[model samples]
Target: MNTNSTEYRLEGDGASIQSLPKISLHDHLDGGLRPQTLIELADEQGLEVPAADADGLAAWFTEQSNSGSLVEYLKTFDLTTAVMQTRAGLARIAREFVHDLAADGVIYGEIRWAPEQHLARGLTLDEAVEAVQEGLEQGADDVRHQGGGIRTGQLITAMRHADRGLEIAELAVRHRDRGVVGFDIAGAEAGFPASRHRTAFDYLASQFMPVTVHAGEADGLESIRSALFDGRALRLGHGVRIAEDLLIERQDDENTYVSLGPVAQWVRDREIALETSPSSNLQTGAITAWGDELVDHPFDLLYQLGFRVTVNTDNRLQSGTSLTRELALLSDAFGYDLDDLETFQLNAAAAAFLPLDDRDELAELIQDGFDEA
Candidate 1:
C-alpha cells in the first residue's frame, strides 16, 4: 500500500483521478488477497499452489479466470480460502487487504466475505468474525500511522447455494456491535434466488439489519424481484441485468427514446445501488446481453438514465485490478471526469449501511478530500 512520493496522477493536463477520494462498497475479502500473502499462507498450511512464485501465481489466476465461466473463475478462491482456514491466515490477508485499499485512496470501504467458508480449521463463526475484525482495525491503524486515512467495515456474507443462511444472518446480527455492519448473499444467483433464504431474510428484517443481495448479474428480472421482495435488499449487487427491463423504442440524433418497465422504474426511483464491476462483469458474462467488451457495458446507459450505478472491483486478484484501475478504465471508456468520480463516491456514501449521521459525515469527508484534489 505504498503511494509515497508517487506524483499524483494527472493525465494530459486533466485532474488526477488517483488523488480523488472514493468509496468502495462491494470489495470481497478472499478475492483481494495478495499473491505473496497467498504463497506464504499456503506454505504455512502445507497446501499446494498452482504456482511457486508470486508473479507465476498471479499469472495462473489471470489465465484460469479468463475462461469466462463464473464457476471456473470462482475456483481460484479455493486456493485463497484454503490458506485462510486459520485465524492467522485470515488476519494477515484482511490486514493486507485494508492496506491495499487505503493505498489506492479508498476513504471508506465495506469488505464482504462469507464466514461459513472460512471455518474449516476448527474456528467457530464468532471466532472467525473476531479475527477479521481484529485485522481490519489493525490495518486501519497501520494506514493512519503511515499518514494515510481510511475507514472500513465488514458486510458479512452468506452463500446463496449454502443452507446456513439463518446461521450467517444471526452471526451478522450478533457481531453488529463489534465490527459487522450489514448482511449480503453471494454465490450462484440463477436458481438460488433470495427467496430460498426467506427465513434468514425474515430474521434480518426482525433485527433491522441492512441487506445487499447478488441479483440480476447471473439471472434476470425475476432474481432481482426476489432480491427486493424476499431478501429486502437495499442494494443490488451488480444488478446490471435490471436493464433487461428496458424497452428501447428508437434512437434519434439527440436523444434515444426508451421506456423503463416496472422493475427498472422501481429500482431507478428507489435509488438502489448497482455494484457494477466492469472487468469482472465482462469475465462472468454479466454483460454478454449487451456485448463482451467494456464499452458494451450498460454502465453508461444506467448512469445516463439515472440509475445509482457505482463502480467496484468485484475480485481484485481474479480481475487483476484495483479501484484506481477500475476508475481509470471507466474514464478511458466513457470520458468521465473528476465530477463523475465524485458522484459515484457520493452515491456509495449515500447507500452505505452506516447510520444516517455517519453517512452524512462520510459524504462531507468525501467532498472535502475530492475538493482538495
Candidate 2:
C-alpha cells in the first residue's frame, strides 16, 4: 500500500493536502488490500490469480473495475476475498488497511466489510470480528509508537441479497463495545431494496444501533426513500443518485431556480451525510445521467445547496485512489480551496458514529490541523 512520495498539493496555494487531518466514512475492507500481500496470500493458499506480479495485479483490478459493468466490476472481489479466508490473512490485511489510511492522513475511519463473506474458512461471525479488531488495535499502536494518532471503527455490513440481515444486525449489536461502531447493508442495490430487511432494521432500531444503508448508487429515489423510512439510515453510501430529485425550473444570470422533491428535502433538511466517492462513481456509471466526467458530478451542486457532502474513497484498490487523491480530484473539478477541503473534513467529523464529545474533539483537531496547514 505504499504510494508515491510525491505529495498532492492544493492548486495556487501550494499547500500539501496529505498533511491535513481527514475522516473516511465509506471505505471497504475487502476492497483495500495491498497487491503484494494479495499475491503472497494467494500463493500461500495455492489459489490461482490473474497476475503473478504486483504491478500486473494492480492493473488487472483497475481494468476490471473500469469495465462499466457492475457484474464485471464485482468479479474482482473474488480474488481479494479468496486470500482472506484465514485468520492470519484477515488480520494482516486489516492491519495494513489502517496503516495505509494513517499514511494518507486519516485521523478517523469507519472500515465496512461483510463478515458473512469471510466465513468460508470456518471462522465464526464473532471470531472474524475479533480478528479484525485485533489488527486494528495493532495498527493503531504502531501509529502511536511512530508519534502519529489514528482511531478507527468497524461498520459491520450485511449483504443485501442474503437472508442473514437479522443475524448480521444482532452480530453488530453483540460486538458494539468491542470495536464495532455501527451497522450497514451493502451489496447489489437494484432489485434488493432496503425494505427486504425491515425485520433487521426494526431490531436494530429497538437496540438503538446506528445504521447506514447502501442506496441511490444502483437505484433511484424510491430506494433512497426506503432506506430512510425502512432502514432508518443515518447516512447514505454513495448516495449520489439522490440528486435525481432536483428539478431545474429555470436559470437566471445570478441564480438558477430549482425545486426539491420530498426525498431531497428530507435528506438536505435533516443533514443526512452523503458519502460521495468521485472516481468510483464515474467508473460504475453512477453519475452517467448527469454526464461522463467529474465536472458533471452533483457534488458541487449539493455542496452549494448546503447538503452535507463528504469525500471518500469507496474502494482504494478498485478505484486506484486514496483519500488525498480524492480530495485533489474534487478540488480540481470545482475550484475548491483549503477552506473548502476543511469544510468537507469537518462535515465528516460531525457525521461520524462517535459520541458527541468525541465528535467535538475531532472537529477541533481538524480545525487545528487545517489552520496549521
Which prediction has the highest lDDT against the true structure?
A: 2
How far residue 45's Cα lies from its native spot in candidate 2, in Å, is: 0.2
Question: Candidate 1: where is the Cα deviation over 4 Å?
Answer: 1-13
TM-score of 1: 0.97
lDDT of 1 by residue, 22-121 (tens): 8899999998988988888888778899899987888887788776667777888888788888888888888998988887889999999999998898
Model 1 backbone overlap count: 0
Backbone clashes, each candidate:
0, 0
Pairs of residues clashing in candidate 1: none
List per-prediction Cα lDDT, in the order shown: 0.89, 0.92
Please list the residue runs of candidate 2 whose C-alpha ends up more than 4 Å from where it truly belongs after superposition. none
* Lowest lDDT block of 10, candidate 2: 1-10
| lDDT score, candidate 1, position 54 | 83
Candidate 2 displacement at residue 289 in angstroms: 0.4
State, as a TM-score between 0 and 1, how close model 2 is to the true structure. Answer: 0.98
User: Model 2 shows how many backbone clashes?
Assistant: 0
**What CA root-mean-square deviation does each model show from the true structure?**
1.8, 1.0
